[model samples]
Target: MRSPTPPDEPRFVLAARHMVETGQWLLPHRGSELYAEKPPTFMWIQAGTYKLLGSWNLSFLLPSLLAALLTLWLTWDMARRLWNPRVARYAVLALFVTLQFGLMAKRAQIDMVLVGMTTLALWGLVRHLLLGPSWGALALAAFAAGVGTVTKGVGFLPLLMLVPWVIWRWRHPQAAGPGRSWKWWLLLPAFLAGTAVWLAPLGIALLQNPDPALQSYAKELLFKQTGTRYANAWHHHQPFWYYLQVMFTLWVPGSLLFPWLVPAWWRRCRRADPRYLLLLGWALLVLVFFSASPGKREVYILPMLPALAVAAAPLLPGLLRRTGVRWVLMLYALLLSLATLVVGYGAVHGDGWAQRNAVKRAIDPWVLPQVGWWLIGFAVATLLVIAVLRLRRAGLAVVLTTVLLWCMYGLGAMPALDPYSSASRVMDQVRERIGPDAELGMVAWREQNLLQTWPQATDFGFKRPVAGQWEDAARWVAQAPERRWLFVLDKVMSPCADRSQVIDIGSANRNNWQLLPGTALQADCVARTHGVVDDADAALQDDGD
Candidate 1:
């Protein structure tokens, strides 16, 4: 079985799959305009992979893995240039084990690719700062910025790191090479070229079509989405301190080190250490930028995590030796071990314990057999922590614990959680019941659901005639000559109460759905209009009788 599709994965996968299947280079989602939202670089990459692998799941996940590997390698290379070999290795491990980075890397999302591109851009800029401005490094930095801008609007945000770089360079004019003449300005054109390669064609096409929908899409993507998000946001609106809350949870054990590391790094920043200043500036700029936005998500600040890891690498040896830090590590390990034991007990005892525990209640009863393996994995992690604590190997303890937890999550928890998290199972049911070629429609269901589940169905794009009502869908089906199926929330089935015409197939993702025979829809229409019949016509019929 395919692993479950996460929240937005289906959208990206279906959009790219459509492009490949229909030979439409533009992304045409059900609700959104063609080519609306972020540029399709990530989707295009997924489409290329799907062509090669013939597996949607593999194609969706491959880019994230590749981007993660690239980020890790780039982090190590950059660390080595700034510090020693030991620090470089630590930087790589720290980045790989960071909870947010690890989780983001395993999913099919544009965020990881955006993070990778921006990291590359930062690396190029840093190289120029350290080794003097070279044509190749400047060009690479500019190109990465442009490509990133197209990937996600925030991709170019990392280019702000150059401000600190320039200030530092000017302060130490000896470090600023004479080559920094007009050549430095070439970066802007390089950025424009990278973005134009993707946007120019689409812009020309939009000019030719000029459909209101297309124009609205371009306007929304280019202006409204960003402006509305920053001002009076439409979604995910939170206080300005939202990222501050996310940092505590998302960064995990890596963030545990931040309390001690940030202060020391701040001291270095004051001393004008160019390396510290560059990394500090990058992380702060990203954090403040996202924090200032009215709309926020935890993953928006992912680009900063690698910079934080690199900034902390030099301090690891010293921090690891602190007694206070070791105590904190031990406490964290102990809490994790206890949590694992509780899960094991719940898994073994079933619903009795699950009734009392919120975490255990969420696990599907069928997956309890896998709980033994999870216990064993957590046991090994706990033992490693004890051994490392005794041996005073703090770095080893952190790395091994992170690896064990990551493995348990990937191998154990993910499989158990798949049914609850992904729509793949629901999609499978649809395929089995309707057959691949059957036309299907959606009523108040997300566009992602229909496209991901039944991409082959011809009736995929029927819009609701009225908001929050299935009457439009009923009317559409009534007018059609062939039978049709609709996926809708179970709560919305009141309008289709007549069981004879609307046959309930089954329910998935907490939504009820049914197949509507075109012939029976006329009856449903009459049933819905029962209260509107004229009383005079009924009296005339009685007089005739």
Candidate 2:
């Protein structure tokens, strides 16, 4: 079963829904002139899937799942090329159970696609380095980079791993193999050629149209989004240490083993183990690149996980044999069990703990009854850890423990959290309040749930006229003879208090919504203006006739 759609899923789904419904690839709610923030590759893929499946439910997730599988396969292949088959198998197991990978792989997002593409690129580069620089491998690597670039701007960032690899190659000329230096130079042209596959069509279409909206999209995609995110982030701003914190917590059991194994990996790198150097370079470059960005999200570091897994795979055998490592694994399992107990207690007993805990707050009261299942899962995982440790199957213990926990969370916790995480319930209420066909506009807030639930509904998107200046939806609403129905957040509804009859819809993301009539909204706007004018006569005079 699929888990509830997270906060960002609806946004991508909405965009894809628009493409399917209206045959428009751009973001419909972002105004007619505004293009989507990211390239249309993922959305287009989602649209195609939705079209084929005739169901929106699993359509978006299909791409994510494919990307995840590709990532796993590529990681395995890279590990195999770099080390032995045994190490490759261990690396795949380690990667499969990683918390970040498991969580992201299940989501309907582009992050996994980016991860998959970068992994492919890294694999291609490693192939060229280890098996001699074949033109085919160089082209594959460069093309992956270009395609990944179109997927997300940071796709090109993985190519930076080549710097360290090149440096190492120069230091030890004998390791350069039979490849000529000129073959390496072909990587640039191949990348540009691959990129042009998408860019060429888009550029021609823009030139043929030559509209402001298309131009705006081009500028934003090429410059504003990338430059602004790095220099001065508009959203999700965090300190450099943000990812460091994520490594410790969000990375989970794998992270517990990372610190123990990293020193050895680095020592191997110094000894010029080509595989170690490649994996190390891939992980460090990706991590440092994302960390340097002012805008940070835990998911941004996902591309590094495969590389880290490969780098750490070599030490798994020795580490598993150590008594101390087994003890540490046991301790980790105990902590997980303790957490499950505390959360289960909090779920059953009415306490302020639910309010204080982020995880608890996500679940609906109805789901509390099912909390026992989650606890059961944790207990089973803990017991399995002990059993596996006893059998000296340390790697299997890690995989089983992590997978069991995530499976339980997906089956029990996710469905329970659906009420808050999704807007389906709220949209039903909205439809009941306003007849299904009534035009709906949003003021001062945009909810992804709204778009996903009701794709056909008109979106005004904070288009309330401030002075006399009017935008698209505001201009249309103002001029229309028919009454308009709008959805406004509680915070923005204060101005319409007496003029409009506000019917409370549900809340999500800490914001409440109310359905309001258009006549009341107009009256409120006029009254507010009149009140402002009454306070200052000079201000009224300046408003002109």
Candidate 3:
């Protein structure tokens, strides 16, 4: 569907194709379809990047690097304003080590962009509320929020956060002042114009194709995926504390540091800025919004984490000022460091963490990073302890915590990037095995077109296969006896190890989806098993393959 398939970013690949082909953002292609492609904003920028840089290989990494750097800078500034430089440093520290945040940075999803927008919103709101609304701050805040609307739906989040705080300020003249002249009002037009300008292209494209799949994915990702979160799915369900539990397990470093370093006033901090209240409201409103949806995934709540993490950072010094509880914080960091080692080692060394015999499954790929910097993370923890040692009083502890914050992020969290790039390796392997004239098949997953990026990708023995399932694969194989077949599956979906005759050229583990033992490819945890199952007689279920 496009040139330069961003092996890790199939969505961006499709979008880039549309951008280069039509010189526009809006396209009538619905993703998650049978050969369906939707035009999105990623390609518009990615295409521009390719032109300026003359390389598509940097696609995923470049944007991620930018997101990270900006996040660090913005977070530092944000923490400084919320607390002392001490708390700000520690707050930024905790944010850096968030694993989910790192993962989001590398994907082609608009969510990372949300991170940037959210940060800018915080900065602008802080300026508007703390220092009084100068035109610059209001305009910046407006621009950021407006962009968020175009990028991810449920635009009411920021409103939930900022509006109430503004009202609070309006009601309390002693605590707040009416911001500068009508200049803040100018932001509304800028917000509308900026958002429309970027999204207008995609809108135009949709009007042209009018494909149902496009409408469906758009509706689901924008409204259902973003708007609603069902407590129960057919197979996967969780308790009300589901998001809370997920965060505890996944957002390791932050969980350890948040309770000890943050202050208490942040609970109703809207008195300071209509914007701070707006940020909190933005995050929580989305939380309640998801609770009402029928379809839910852990990622549905991703946007909320950044705000909470940033907000929590400002409290570290306040918590430390309370006395003996600071030791509890150190203990938590120690426990976290150990947990990271266990999970990291399990993923890198375990014999396919989920193995139940012939119909085996993989849990490791879903678990670990390839090369962890345990030593570095621990060193950062040590810094936190040292910082605590230097603290003679609450105020001193606050100062120490702030410096250690960013130190922790750099050491503890930044190394686990690049796990998604594993797919690029699978694309290479599949291309090497498949040859000219082989047709590809689409089965279970969403990243099918990811394979098409490689120059040799088109020469295939399979039908340009991507994310196909057992049933769909069996049907494709049955229709044409001559073309070879390869099916890709995540551990839960298809346990290839359970079969007696299947040949595994790569690892069976689907978690982290790396190549077989000894090799270094992270794509598709692919396996190729050929046999003489009569094409006509082969079943489409588990028993068939």
Candidate 4:
């Protein structure tokens, strides 16, 4: 709870909270505006957790953790089925220690859950296509893919696994195939059934209510967020080789083995090993599929990790004994420890680099130095473990070092960084300056601002333009000038707002905020009323009902 919620994390949790509060689960809202950027399957799980536990702090992140564990379990079981128990263990360990996969599992992000569903889908396909022609497994896999699609819009990526499966099955005619061509058609209904969990409810709700805004929300969610996003992404544009960089860095020690694994995989694939042909082939397809897209993110290809692990699992026993691989593991751990120590030294001494970082991150002067000491101590401990264990046990040392690093950061640094990153400290200042009785209105706010002060604060609108929000916010303050205040981003404060009358609320989440009293509104200054919508009034009306 103390750790900062990434910008998207708060947006998702807030939408889920709204779902629970309004008893309207079909459509999710982000501060009165429809949050149609994503389908609501993931939020349904989050909101379900909130309803069951009645604790946002505990419930919001549980889904990601569970999904991560599910991914590991599927990886382990699939490897065991394909090879042996030893390979299974290696595959799970390889995935668990992966920098990106482990990090996602620890957060409240949708990607991890989507990865879990996709991995499940892949696992079922492996069982049905590679191992046998089990209609039940194929159906289940299709359903999982459908569920995954609604979860993140790319869930159907697993269905692409069939492309490689068909080729491999054709090449090796004696192996299990998709089985009896007609049986494949039955899987469509299963996929629809999974999608219906969300779409079906949504269809019924729209029929019953039929609001134009809701209809627009449905269109944007179904079409733009999926097809348009893939066809022409507006942001996060990168070159084709972006994911290649991601694999090399973010995949870490496991990725370090790629040089050797590549040739070994080629040899096995050439020899027509079904396990390698299916797993490796599907993994390659995933990589190519994502790389072909214009929009790229490190997490977008996360589902491919399980396939990579399983493909590499059989060779791990031999790969681990290689002196070159062991040395790489040992050196990587040592360099990581040294880097932490050096950073800690700089932070503790209050060097220019450290101070600049602290300033940008809005970290407290005292907090950085305190976090520094912990990092220094942890790094020292890591060094001792590395020295004692040495190269022969390099794998163990690296795993231990990685685990310790996460523990130190999660247990020590996250809480210390939370106040600034989560905007709680700024919100605290707002509360202290105005006292509990004052009404707070938000303008040009981010998710954390509203999430931190929800029900206590009224947001103009998340999707509305800044000018429109400002106009609404100004009007709102005019009604109760004495008791009402506007908490606004520094960049968005109107030109007419009297600076002398505003209280600087300090920085949080890399943005400046100020507590603006209604008296700060200049007498001659007119609110930018163009393109304004009275969403604040509509949201208030909904709340009243």
On a 0 to 100 scale, what is the lDDT of residue 275 in model 4?
Answer: 82
TM-scores, all models, native as reference: 0.87, 0.88, 0.64, 0.95
After superposition, the stretches of candidate 3 with alpha carbons farther than 4 Å from their true spots are: 1-9, 14-25, 28-39, 81-87, 106-108, 179-187, 203-239, 257-263, 266-286, 292-295, 300-314, 321-325, 340-429, 432-545
Misplaced by over 4 Å in model 2 are 1-6, 26-35, 176-178, 355-364, 384-391, 462-484, 494-500, 523-545
Report the Cα RMSD per candidate: 7.7, 5.6, 8.9, 4.0
Q: Each candidate's lDDT (Cα)?
A: 0.70, 0.70, 0.49, 0.84
Model 4: how far is 381 from its true place, Å? 2.2
Model 2 global lDDT (CA atoms, 0 to 1) = 0.70
Error of 1 at 175 (Å): 3.7
User: RMSD (Cα, Å) of candidate 3?
Assistant: 8.9
- Pick out the ten consecutive residues of candidate 2 with the lowest summed lDDT: 536-545
Candidate 2 has which clashing residue pairs, if any?
Answer: none
Candidate 4 lDDT (Cα, whole model)? 0.84
Error of 3 at 355 (Å): 9.2
Q: What is candidate 1's lDDT per residue for 245-276, written digit by digit as tens?
A: 78887887777777898899989999989889
What lDDT tens digits, residue by residue, belong to model 4 across residues 356-450? 88989778788878888878988998999999999889888878988898888778877778888788888888888988888999987778888
* Cα-lDDT of candidate 3: 0.49
Candidate order by lDDT, highest to lowest? 4, 1, 2, 3
